[model samples]
Target: MADIDMAELGPDRTLLLVDDDAPFVARLARAMEKRGFLPETAESVAAGKAVASSRPPAYAVVDLRLEDGNGLEVVEALRASRPACRIVVLTGYGAIATAVAAVKFGATDYLSKPADANDITNALLSRGEAPPPPENPMSADRVRWEHIQRVYELCDRNVSETARRLSMHRRTLQRILAKRSPK
Candidate 1:
């Protein structure tokens, strides 16, 4: 991916990048540094919390999964520590619930993994500079059904936990699962 133009980013901004993947974090930190940010990294959620508490970043790029805990915990803590900071959640192919929860927990945006540096740069300035998330082609019902399936997998086929996590009644989750499952 091409480097982002740092001239576009405002001056003297700080960015905190939290990702367990050391190589990925390094690359992104380099890219953001080129874009004029003073980027710091935390390889675990615990370290991220410590950094955030000591000096909140103006923006944070958080991966949805981490070694010690889910990145949602870090995202929530970051919000508490720096409500003024902009957050962007990084999601893998099948982790939509976590991504959605990130937005609900106050992430400024969410981007799918394998995203380019351009994507990261835009997310940083997304709050007032970028366009709104475009509508999905699928219907609301279809999106709900898809999210239910992802939740089921995330909970390791535990219907009760899936239901609770999705905020649906247990029976409702069962009904949805039944509809999607083989006879």
Candidate 2:
């Protein structure tokens, strides 16, 4: 496959990527390196913060959930360490509240998991791509909400039965669905 125009990023720059998924960290780091960036990978938020604090990077791609803690913490830490560094948050669970909170906390953008190297590279580059839409087909929130809404509606908004069908706690299901807004 052809590479992204690294010029879109306005000169190759250093990038810090924080994700606990080993394969994803390696794959994305390699891809960004090929795209003319010097990318660093961290398997945990603590390590990511350490790298950023020790030597600031031009950009950071942060995962929202980490083995040790929330990736948002890492983003905050990066911002504090290097106020100029750009940040993007990736998560398996993409809620609007979480996404909006990420932006409020200083992420330049947010992406859901299954995002490819190119998507991440573009985010790091600040190339003007919109934050991944909450309703996007790849979005975990859309998929989970739709499924829960279907069951809830089918069960006449009966929280217990809906939760049972989904194999989740009633309260957890309620919280998830509560975050859903009316169309």
Model 2 regions lying over 4 Å from their true place: 1-3, 127-183
The estimated TM-scores of all candidates read 0.66, 0.70
lDDT of each: 0.81, 0.80
lDDT of 2: 0.80
- Clashing residue pairs for model 2: none
> What would the per-residue lDDT of candidate 1 be over residues 1-183, giving only the tens digit for each residue?
545566656664899999998999999999888777899999998998888889889889988888798777878888999897888888654466766788898888888765667778777776566565544445677667777787787899999999899888999889888885332
Q: Model 2: how far is 168 from its true place, Å?
A: 7.5
Residues 1-183, model 2: lDDT tens digits: 336666666553888889998988898888878878888999997898899789878788998988799888888888898887888899876689999999888898888776887777667665565555434353565666666776787788899998898889988987887684433
